[model samples]
Target: MSRAAGRLKVGIRVPPCDRADRIVRTVRRAEELGFDSAWFPDSQLLWRDVFTTLTAAALGTEQIDLGTAVTNLATRHPAVIASAARSVAELAPGRFTLGLGVGDSSVAPVGLRRSTTAEMREGLTVLRTLLNGDEWEFTGPGGTVRSRLRDPHPAIPLHLAASGPRNLRLAGEVADGVILLSGVSPRTLAGAMDRVREGARAAGRVAEAVPLTVSAYCEVTDDIEAAARRIKPICATIARNGGAPFLALAGIEVDVPDVVDGVYPDLVHAEDWDTAVRVASAWVDDAAALRFAEEFCLFGTADEIARRLRALHADGVRGVFLQHVGSYDPPLDLIEAVGASVLPAL
Candidate 1:
């Protein structure tokens, strides 16, 4: 089946949990409720197997597309990743997408280094070739694998989760889509698109042909302050890690630490709730959160969020991956709300 076009697609990243039945139910609900896609996070040690979760989602959902938000080719060899992706694609045919990324701290805990751009590019090349049913020889520090698909192949779209300019450019050159991280502003999105366009130009392809996806935390509530409070922790952590540079650009001041060494304490160890609120307020305050929610999240009253999303479509955002950072149940409400009120308008 050909991919849909001309409007922003809405998707949600599935939570990592042992309750496969619950996860499957949520995915089915998301599909039935009108989300365009459902994504699984990749973290072998921290979360359940991404492939396994995706398989569950595939079985439970008939219409929604399924894929990894970002899986590292370094953790699993390119051949292994290709095989797993192919297996999942066989389950869902044209509905599977493979979202690849440079391996991060998740693999580091298991004594593996983060993958370099060269490695990611090489791995993507091999995976793409293998997915196309072409025989290929892949040799790395581990070993060599030479194989071709014996079964019928599926048209699995390959997307890269990219943030930096160079990575965005590479994604445009090589991938079917690019997934932008959370906390990006309109200027940042435009800048990233410029890099994507440059890469497409170099590759002799049109820039607009490549899909662009952005991931964000979302919440909807009448009490705006309460919603901002709910979103504080996640925003603070992201700010500490330099994920919210746009906060500074947006003229919001935050005492973000210069270096983030420890994991939990660096984010959670504050004097009081007010401190947490202050640290995160610049990026996650009611108005700021609402602004971000409007621009980045698929939250708010259905009418308001739909208007915001339509504006994003006008601004060239092809897709959004709504991430639930507060309570898990609200995401279900968000899905239903979007389906009942926003999707119809879209």
Candidate 2:
């Protein structure tokens, strides 16, 4: 069925792990299943080229919105990102959003540091200038040069994915939308939104004008305790990376080693998810995992998820993009389950 009026916007995060054509099929299927949007993450080493997958998706789907759940300015220059965004926006018109982040897997493997807050400010200005068909200056080894994107797509919305307080505020000041990496805990979400609104007011913008989309791990299961095991790595990673306070807000506390061995790349995007779970289980017990699931994730029956989503919408969340457990495969099951059961309920 088509989207109904006043229904909360729902999206899915699909990895570009396969061929472009095959990835396009997954996006088309999500569209057919009534998902409002499809977001693709970018990591050169981990997945296929994100822009290629997005381009294919744009051409293959008729009505679904498309976005980079996030791409980075570190691995790719702002000019390159602007040019690529314009290309996809050309194909999809008003259906494309360009999401930016400080970078993680996309930069770490390449021996590049993630962009600093100052760098992100500069990068956003450059992107805005180029995408709006205005000239921007670039300083390089060759020399400083001024350039403008040819056939720029100015209307492409720029979303920022942020979890940290500083970045959350930056998103408020500049982004067309905010992609909250903070999970769905009400206390944590409220605190994050306060920072965003503070920045918006400081920048002389209305807080309500900035749409917010929360990114949370979601599962449809009768036995939530068992399914909660999959998020052990996520809990450990959050605690390891300065989110212990956020976890505490959920009444969950964890302390993990700075460097976890055995999991390739990282815990959040571990290739061997079972192994990662095993490694993380030492720090995060079943009770803690269950707590995380209940607080930060949409884990439960369809009715439960529907109620939680409606509550989130009432609390001013405009959209939410559900992410399945694994990063390697398409969330086909999640799409089918939620679309059939949850969307109609919403």
lDDT for each candidate structure: 0.71, 0.91
Best by lDDT: 2
Q: For model 1, what is the alpha-carbon lDDT of residue 91?
A: 84
Query: For model 1, which pairs clash?
Result: none
* TM-scores of all candidate predictions against the true structure: 0.84, 0.98
In candidate 2, list every pair of residues with a backbone clash: none
Q: Which has the greatest TM-score?
A: 2
What digit string (tens of lDDT, one per residue) describes model 1 on residues 1-346?
2248766788887755556667788888888877888888787765678888888777777888888988997788877888888888888878999999877635756878877777778888888788788989856788987878665354788899887777888988988888887433676677778888888889998888888888876554555555655556555565565556655555444455554443423333332445555656554556655554444445566666667667767877788877765322325766665677777877
Model 2 shows how many backbone clashes? 0
Candidate 2: TM-score?
Answer: 0.98
**Could you list the CA RMSD of all candidates, in the order they appear?**
3.8, 1.6
Candidate 2 on 1-346: residue-level lDDT in tens?
A: 1234366789999999899999888888888888899999999999999999998998999899899989999999999999999999888877898999999989988899989888988899999999999998889999999989988888988899998989989999998889998888999999999988988988999998888989989998999999999899999999998999999988998998887889989998999999999999999999999999999999999999999999989988888999999889998999999999988888
